[model samples]
Target: MPSDIHHPAAAFNRTSFEACVVPYLDAAYNLARWLARDDTDAQDVVQESMLRAFRYFHSFHGDDARVWLLAIVRNTFYSLRSKAAADAKHETFDDEAHTLIDEAPSPEARALISVDIQALQAALENLPHPLREVIVLRELEECSYKEIANITGQKIGTVMSRLARARERLKAELSSSSTEARRHDVR
Candidate 1:
């Protein structure tokens, strides 16, 4: 019986790719979804990023695959947006990202939350992509200023400024929506 041993270099290449890059797929997809704002577009971005990542994987220097793949995701989104002549300054969210908060929580967070708070989540989801991404990464992902800057390819000051503006806009939107509901109730 002859046992066939694959070449050492190809085996090593396969091992490294599976270990370093394959595990980051979910994280890549999530970040891409946020950036692209559409599930279909997100998938496309992920595929493109994966191909690019694999092509350049040999140059990777660190173990933080999340950040590396996320950079690819960000780059892919910008490439498509620019090619389509999208407004560089404007941020848009696709409908798939829309969702109301879990109103009837199975946990204790809801103990302190009222209908207004639930409405606030829905309002925040309606915010523009740039604003929403900052909120999601900062608040939900609990990323630091430096990490946010790296992921979005912005200066640290820009990340702080954008977060402040996004929070202000979200507050106003939630307040107005809640106020309109109250007005309707009174009517």
Candidate 2:
């Protein structure tokens, strides 16, 4: 049999897809991780999302690949979440007893950042999903309101409102945590 030769158009499409999608993998993973709240699940979501993105890449004509890819990532996460929810009904898992162990930080790293980082992370994680997503997209991902609206399929007004609410809640949580820490210090 003769060696199979690549079609020029197929080669171009593959190159274009890689160029557009590869650079934004980190951003996609970050968004998925924040939404899923688990590293393994986030990785799974990203992998599935990449497949979806590739399958539908021909339809993508937008200028911002990051926003487009993030939209796919967010949708993939929700789809997985829905399936997990359905599965959860038939299972009996005690989340409180299921703990995840994080890698230990160096002593100096812990001393410099651990307390504050942990508090902030906890606060972010405690926010409602809508609020947490807006925070991650706007602040951490540095996405503009228009970008967020496109990714979330929300109106611009809704995106702005959610972001404002998320910021206020974060401020309140951080302030309360700081006060509690100060009290412990005084004690």
Candidate 3:
């Protein structure tokens, strides 16, 4: 263990948690929720993460608690994922905005997108967790490479590589879904 791990402040202190950590609670909850995808599971993971963070607060320093806490949330989420394996298969989504194939889409196409955000959410929910997280964090959350690496415990290089791959996979998925929609219309 590092020297910080041995300090009294590293052990347990409610005031420390309140001062250094309370501000980040929501961010922790959000990251955990995104990774876990169920209200109960997300809450469970956040609680576990906060407890562990309290125990290890000495190891935390500087002004990076938010990213550091998110890393914990990510790890806790993965542990729960392995143990439970009965939750939503999480997926990462991209931030590329799709313009209306035409703003003045024909009634038929309007009917298609009338399915709207719900259909998009369902499609996002269907993606694998790795792809989903990368897409959500990178595109939706608009996190920088350093921030992502800090939260994910991945090397910045790995983040970039995985981010590129995640975008490619999401592109493939949307392309296929669009094809299917077109096929349905032709029938």
Candidate 4:
């Protein structure tokens, strides 16, 4: 067998894969982070998604690479989530062994984050997964409705409806949070 470096087809595939997929690694990680809601889990999801993309690179036509990659990322996250849920069912919960701890940030660390930013992040986190993912894709990643529909495997109409609902929910959450904050300030 010839070495891959000397093989023209192999070299071309590798180059094309790098050119199409490597530039979107950060975007992939951001989507995963928002979906998984945990830094370590998001990193793991991105790693698995990249491996899947590389394995299936040959099947990829000359379409939108970002949408393709994000779809894979979204699928991988849901797969892992489902598997984790199944695994949790078999585990025994021990109250003593799983004691919760309060991990509040230091005052300096808290001060570094803007109040409005924190409230927004908290509200986003509180949204259901479906709404949250759509909001993150459209608002944060700047994906169009068609791209989001492709990434989410939803119809364009569904994507639009979800986005509208997510926006309204976010507005209500932000308004309530600001009101509470103002009350605290006045006290």
State how far residue 182 of model 2 sits from its true place (Å): 2.3
lDDT of 4 by residue, 105-185 (tens): 664434333455667777887888999999999998999999999999999999999999999999999998878766555
Number of the top TM-score candidate: 2
Backbone clash count for every predicted candidate, in the order shown: 0, 0, 6, 0
In order, candidate lDDTs are 0.73, 0.82, 0.72, 0.84
**Model 2 lDDT per residue over 142-166, tens place:** 9999999999999999999998999
Cα lDDT, model 1, residue 158: 89
Q: Candidate 1 lDDT, tens digit per residue, 53-94?
A: 877877888657676777777888778777875454334554
Instruction: Rate residue 142 of model 1 by lDDT.
Output: 69
Per-candidate TM equals 0.70, 0.82, 0.66, 0.80
| Candidate 4 vs. true structure, TM-score | 0.80
How big is the positional error of residue 83 in model 3, measured in Å on the Cα after superposition?
3.1
Q: Report RMSD for candidate 4.
A: 6.6
Ranking according to lDDT, highest score first:
4, 2, 1, 3
For model 4, what is the C-alpha lDDT against the true structure? 0.84
What is the model-wide C-alpha lDDT for candidate 2?
0.82
Clash count, predicted structure 4: 0
